[model samples]
Target: MKKQLLLLVLLFLGSIALLQSQVTGTVTDEDGTPLPGASVVKKGTRVGTTTDFDGKFSIDAIIGDRLTISYIGYQPKEVLINSTIMSITLVSGVQLAEVVITGSRNPNRTATESTVPIDVIDVKQLANAAPQVNLNQILNYVAPSFTSNTQTISDGTDHIDPASLRGLGPDQVLVLINGKRRHTSSLINVNGTFGRGSVGTDLNAIPTAAIQRIEVLRDGAAAQYGSDAIAGVINIILNKNVDELLINVT
Candidate 1:
């Protein structure tokens, strides 16, 4: 009688183990688009697996086990494991506005840490609203303490308006393209409009469409970058992206 009782107990334990089977499922959005990297977890336990590139996931579970699926920007779902194959669709209920940031992230920076102020202008965003495609005119409207005045009567400064900063002459404000010093293409001459006619770069030479962004160091950069930056520094970063090509008409 003792041997028969032990045999019955072993057979009962084996039957319980055989009840559990493998469960597979595919996770998709409401529109049937596969949601790759979605989270899939078995309820009441830590066993879980993320959806593959094809949104397919597999796990070992019994017929009554529960599964929870979750994804970012979508409502989570829960379902009972009734079959070996399952199809889960996450609802599009949760949505938040996108925060667009152009500048680099600096968490611990304080306002008093640096004396010089820098103005960051996103040229790509300005391209749509600007009246003309002139880079010089766009800077005058967006950046503070900077101006590009067109001299209707001046000699060489006629077509190419000079750029100035902090009420200083164009020569006093150093211009840099991609961190390298950009020398003045020609002299202002006659001590006219923007300084003693020694050095001045042509702002009109750089195409506005090719520029990505501009960083203007407000004032007092001469101590670090020499007399060229006595008023400030204007760094023009051109677009080095390999995605698009630009064509001009006349």
Candidate 2:
């Protein structure tokens, strides 16, 4: 009886060893280039491995088990492990084109190619986070270096608040609307305010409803633009792709 029990135990161990098998695979892109660092994971389990420098990976898996292969910028692929070796070709994901014009002279230049730091705020972001309808107030909260203060009764300056960038005077910062030079407000801040003795642009003059996106170039562009861009340049791009006339009361 003891010998019979030993034989049954050996058969069970052999069956278990046969159930678990080693799986090897090579991951490649659509162009047939080896994609190193690709992840290969068994479905619904923690068993996984990554491709080596040659885009080859090996992991323990059973037959009929599913394997998921994934890589950055590529579409994920899944296959059933019918064999020990697998050759996977991952397709590329769809990429969207971006438009950037703040720091680059070329209109077709992307934001990643710009040497200067740039911040782009869309209309939705501006209006969603703004507590007040004033553009200066919205920029003060959104922009890093922009600042503005409300004047109670400081002549015409109360109506037209002055805004500064990078802790510099208001006149030091240049403002552009739709790529055109926007004129500064006639009211100069002569009172004791944040930007005293500086005439700044009346950003409130342009309704936030009309704006599409605001691009702020944080680097000095005196050589490219002019001396007016000593502090930085704030370019307000208007929406030209409006198919329907939408108006916001507030």
Candidate 3:
């Protein structure tokens, strides 16, 4: 009885060896790009190994055993271990939730490359170099297309010293502070000033010390910025200096 039991145990072990073999394969995407660090495991068992940088793996398995493979950003796959060599391709999975882009300080896209005619003026440099004392006076000397005049006799409209651009009326040009519309006085007719029939803002109120730069768009933008910006657009950017003090001497 003991000899019969020993013979049966030996036959059972030999049959198990005949059914098993070594399997090898490569894992990749539809584009044939190797998927490094991919997971490869046998079904219903913890025995498994990960693919190398070349997306190749070797594992021991029996005939008809199931092999599961998976990777990050790719769909999972399963294959029957019928052949010694195999090729696996995984499809893409998941998607990016959101994406953002910013170009505020991109040096390649400077003012010179603008499609419209634009004049970028450094306020701090001009105030220190030029002899002009006010914003109106400084711009008058630098920009020939811009014009401004003091009013004394027309409906009390001299407070703002209305300005114009591109030989257009004073009300035609639009003024913006930090890209927002600056408030202006009510419409009124002028008799003794070049900016006659003006409804303009107070340019003198804005000190040069508080400004960083000025962007002058000398183009017809009525279709884009409404009728008020028909002649052009003047945008003022404020100073963003940190941990420093600025003193302007008159």
Evaluated with TM-score, which candidate comes out highest? 2
- Superposed model 2: Cα runs more than 4 Å off: 1-110, 241-244
Each candidate: what lDDT?
0.81, 0.84, 0.82
lDDT string for model 1 (1-250, tens) is: 9999999999998877757677999999989999999999999999999999999999888888899999998988899988889999999878667868774323222123455667777888887776657878888887768888777677777776777898887788898999999878665545356665656788778887788888888786888899989889989999998589886442
Which stretches of candidate 3 lie above 4 Å from their native place?
A: 1-110, 242-245
Best by lDDT: 2
Which of candidates 2 and 3 reaches a greater lDDT? 2
Q: Is candidate 1 or candidate 2 better by lDDT?
A: 2
Q: Candidate 3's residue-wise lDDT over 87-118, tens digit each?
A: 88989964668768754322322376777767
Report how far residue 65 has shifted in candidate 3, in Å. 90
Give the TM-scores of the predictions, in the order they appear.
0.52, 0.53, 0.52
Question: Which of 2 and 3 is ahead in TM-score?
Answer: 2
- True-vs-predicted CA distance for residue 218, candidate 2, Å: 1.5
